[model samples]
Target: MSTELLTYLFVGVTFTLYIGIAIWSRAGSTSEYYVAGKGIHPIANGMATGADWMSAASFISMAGIISFVGRDGAVYLMGWTGGYVLLAMCLAPYLRKFGKFTVPDFVGERYYSQIARVVAVICVIFISFTYVAGQMRGVGIVFSRYLEVDIVSGVLIGMGIVFFYAVLGGMKGITYTQVAQYCVMIFAFMVPAIYISMLITGNPIPQLGFGSEVTGTGMSVLEKLDGLSAELGFAQYTDGSKSTIDVFFITMALMVGTAGLPHVIVRFFTTPTVRDARKSAGFALLFIAILYTTAPAVASFARINLLNTVSEASYKELPKWFSNWENSGLIAWVDKNEDGKIQYTAGKSFAGKPSFTDERGESGERLINNAPTEGVNELYVDRDIMVLANPEIAGLPGWVIALIAAGGLAAALSTAAGLLLVISTSVSHDLLKQNLAPNISDKQELLAARIAAGAAIVIAGLFGIYPPGFVAQVVAFAFGLAAASFFPAILMGIFYKRMNREGAVSGMIAGLAFTFAYIVYFKFVNPADNNPEHWWFGVSPEGIGTLGMIINFSVSFVICHLTAPPPQHIQDLVEEIRVPSSNNAAAPVEGGQTANA
Candidate 1:
């Protein structure tokens, strides 16, 4: 079958499976809607959490970024995975022991203030909405390429599917769906990697292949990559350019943000016990590592393949994949220097470039670029297209390409659903039922949650259609906001017995305001001011969250010292959460009821 037909078949089958799972797991009550009735198995919840945590940036863009930046990209791998260890050790079990349906619920009750709860809700909504926009954009990129639709239409289709499942089943539906999504995405990611590895190094495992000698060249993969990079004026694959302090702060920001993200934190709430929550976090990290480890290998292989295939090749002699991506506007070649040969090199100038025009004669011929210039650098490649285009570039089978399409959609949709759920619950449960409408019926709350989820989907779709920045950039900002606002508050709530509502609320507002102001000023107000000279203490906007987090901790501590301490009962509650043995294995239901396991 053709690639298009194969893609349709694979994508259609996966969508059907998701819809089937959603229908089967529809939530009946607010408990199920919020936390899957607190009955999900540790292993299952772990897999679901893995799926929820690995967004489109993880699936589609991570390898691409790593391919271009080499060792400098290790921060993402370390930062994201390290955060899980923090979650497992410092946050998950304690939060699980608290037996709350939402993060805001824990914060509100712990601080004993409606203002604190509202602040937590605002943070969750901001973080979740910012992150969900990227997922929707990932969905659109997949659909637009494989299904041959515009990005807006693709986003609408994704919104429709997610709304059907997420609104109907809530967390219950999302958990089961995410488990399936994890399997599909992992398989899709690994298959091409293994194939490419075997083709180049005679090894099936990509990690091993990366270190093995190339089959014909007999040079180690790293050595060959380094040589090619030097010849092409690119950075060596094993060397890094970022300053040590920047790397440290960026990694720390991502780690803290990962632990603080409300969607991921709420996953632990679905587990039966504090012990299970810890165990589930381990399983989630293990599953995430499978892809995380493979990503670097994929990056190495793609870099090698791309350089070998494109370097010094004439425009007319370029492979079909070149033209395919060129038509999609991902790859552009200007034929600078007027030599028909395409030059792939770093620091190629764009001065005196000519306008592109079709030069086909009556014979109906076509060329990628009709413009010619004196510049040596002639091509522009977008990094975001690397992974999706890798299989095609390597001449993989149509079915394999189709599988990738399904996997990308799965990765995007699964995370989008999880974030939308967070947004929905924050509005319906935390803002309305808990604070504003304490007497609201469970049925009314459930209805409100569904309505909120639908609205979130629409808003998320709009953001996808008109994104303010790149996928990875927006995601990093979301993490920064989470790190600054939520991580400190939650960490202090569980660990500091004397932490009062005044301190916690002030810390959250201060952190959120500081981080948001820095990101907006650098990213939107003055893009030119984002350089090192303008940055505070040489920390970039992405790493500014680390500073913001410190500010939050310091401010909160000073405020706590100046104000009254938490009440004795509240201090006892903090002790209760800290001592996991005091709580029951199963989460308590409404009205302080516990169901039998």
Candidate 2:
């Protein structure tokens, strides 16, 4: 069968499976909608968390960024994976023990303030929206390529599917759906890596293949990549360009951000016990590591294949994938100097290079300038297209390419479901049922959750149609916001008995304000001001969250010491969460109890 037909078959099958799972696991109550009735097995919840954590950024974008950036990309691998350890140890179990349906529920009860809960709801909404936008965009990219639809149409299709499943099943449907999604995404990601590895280095495992010598060239993969990078005027693959401090802080930011992410933390709440929550985190990390470890190998393989395939090739002689991507507007080439030979290098501009003229050809196609320039650079490749294009670039089988299409959609949709849940739960449970409409029935709340989820999907779809930035960059900003606003407050609430509502609320607001201001100023107001030299304390925008986190911790502690300590009963509630006793574990509730321990 043709690639298009194969893609349709595979993607169609996956969609059918997702819809079936959603229907099978349809939720009946608010508890079922919010926490899957708190009956998820540790292993199952772990797999679900893995799927939730590994969004499009991990599945579609990480390898692509790593392929071009090389060692610098290690931060993403380490930062994202390492944060799970913190979640498992410092946050997940305690939050799960608190037995609340939402992150803001814990914050509100823990701090004993409606203001604190509202603040948390705002933070969760902001972070979740920022993250979901990228997932929506990922869905669009996959659909645009595989289904041959425009991005807006692709986003709408995705929104429709997610709305059907997520609104119907809520957390229950999303969890089971994610379990299947994890399997599909992992298989799709691994197969191409293994195939490319065997083709390049005669090794089946991508990690091993990345270190092995090329089959014919007899040079190690890294050595060959370094040589090619030098030849092409790009940085060596083994070396990184970021400063040490920037790398340190960015990694720290991602680590804390991962732990603080409301969606990930909410997954632990689905587990039955605190011990299960901890165990689930371990299993989730293990599953995530499968793809995380394979990604670098895939990056190495893609870099090698791309350079070998494109370098010094004439425009007319280039492979079919070249023209395919070019037609998609992701890859561009101009025959500068009219030599007809393609030059693929860094820092090349399309301006003053080539332009389409008004004149028409015999076929009625617009005629463009074909004159070649003396410069040896004529191509521009968007990094985001690397992974999706990798299978084609390597001449993989049609079925394999189709599987990747399903995998990308799964990755994007699964995480989008998870984030939308956080958004909806925050609005319905935390904002409405808990604070505003305390007497609301469970049935009413369930309807509100569904409505909120549908609204969130529409907003997420709009963001996808007009993305604020690249997938990874927007996600990094979300992480920054999470790290600054949520991590410190949650951690302090669990670890420090003296922490009071006044301090916790103040810290969250300060952190959220500071991080949001910095990101907006650099990313939107003055993009030129994002350089290292201009950054406060030399911290890049990606790493600024670490500083914001510190500010939160410092400000909260200072204010806590200055003000009266938390009431004795609140301290007892803190002690109760710290201990893992099953007897003390509170029953999961919409409006959780005040600190009456």
Candidate 3:
């Protein structure tokens, strides 16, 4: 069958599987809708969390970023995984023990105020919506490229899938579906990476293969990569050219932001016990590492493959994938020097320089059709295409390509569903049911939840269509918001007895406002592109989340010292959340009655 037909078949089968799963598991009560009835296995929950956590950025853009950034890119690998460590060690157990339906319950009760709960709800909505928009965009991009559909159509299709299961199954449906998604995404990511590694270096482990000697080349992989990069004026693959302080702060920001995210924290609530929460966290990291470790290898291999292919080729002779991507505008090439050879020079110059010399030519700077590009030039291949394009770049079979398409969509859609669930539950359970209309029936509340979820999906899709520049940048802001606003309040509520309502509410506002203002000022108002020399203390807007988080902790602590102590009842609530008893885990809030009769 043709590639086009095969793509349709693959997408069709994947959609059927998702629909089948949704039908098999329909959430009945609020408990099932919220936390999978608190009966999920540790391994299963871990898989689900992995699928939920690994967004399009992780599946599609991660390796490509690593490929271009080299050692400097290790920040993502370390920052992302390290956050899980913090989660497993410091946060997950207590939150799981709290046993609440939503994170706002903990904030409200622990801080002894409904106002704190509202703040928590706002934070959750902000973080989840911003992150979900990226996932929707990712889904659309993958669909447009592989399925030959427009991004708008792709987004609508994704919206339909997310709407069905997220509304029907809630967390219960998402948990199981994500488990299956994890398997598909991971296997699809690793297979092509391993094959390409073997083809290039005679090694199976892509991580080690990145540093090992290249086949038929006496030089080590890093050495070869470094040499190739140098020839093109790019940074060495193994060198650290970035300012150490900036990288440190950026990595730290990402780690703390990961730990602070409400959706990620709520995953722990689905487990049966504190022990399960801990174990699930470890398992989630292990599953995540399977891809994280291999991602670097894929990036390195693809970088080399891309350069070799496009370096000397003419436009007409380019492969189908190249032409297809170019037409989509995700990839662009400009022959600046007009030497008829595409150049891969690394300097600040936007002009094209010859990337690879044509072995067939003697004196002319003319690029050869033998390679991927026609003339000496610079090509802009989007970082997001690395994972999806890997199989095609390596000359894999059509099935593998099809599998990749499904896998990319799976990764994007799974995360989108999870985030949307969080947004809906926050509105329905926390805001509407708890505060607005406490007497609403469960059926009516669920209907409200469905409406909330559907609305969030449309807004998220629109944002994706007009995405802000830099996928990771927006993601970092999402994380920063979580860390600054949610992490401090939640952590203090659990670990500090002195944390009072006033302190918690004030602290959340401080954190949220500070983080938002800093990002807006640097990202939009003054803007980095327009004012390159005006960064605050040399910190990029991406790293401001860390600063915002510190400000939150400081304000929370200072306010707690000056304010009255928490009421005796709130102290007991803290103790309850910390304890490992079944009763404590039964209801997330002490007075909030169960929605189910």
TM-score of 2: 0.94
* Residues 166-206, model 1: lDDT tens digits: 99989999999999999999999999999999988999999
List candidate 1 segments past 4 Å from native.
Answer: 348-375, 582-597
Against the reference, the lDDT scores of all candidates come to 0.86, 0.87, 0.79
Q: Kindly provide the TM-score of model 3 when superposed on the true structure, using C-alpha atoms.
A: 0.92
Q: Compared with the true structure, what per-residue lDDT tens digits does model 3 show for residues 532-588?
A: 256666776667777778888888888888988987866876776666655333533
lDDT of 2 by residue, 214-288 (tens): 999979999999999989888899999899999998899999999899999999989877778878988998999
- Candidate 2, residue 495: Cα displacement in angstroms equals 0.4
What lDDT would candidate 3 get against the real structure? 0.79
How many clashing residue pairs are found in candidate 1? 1
Evaluated at residue 594, the lDDT of candidate 2 is 29
State the lDDT at 582 in candidate 1: 47
- In terms of lDDT, which candidate is strongest? 2
Backbone clashes in model 1, listed as residue pairs: 337-373
Please report how far candidate 3 places residue 336 from its true position, in Å: 3.2
What lDDT would candidate 1 get against the real structure? 0.86
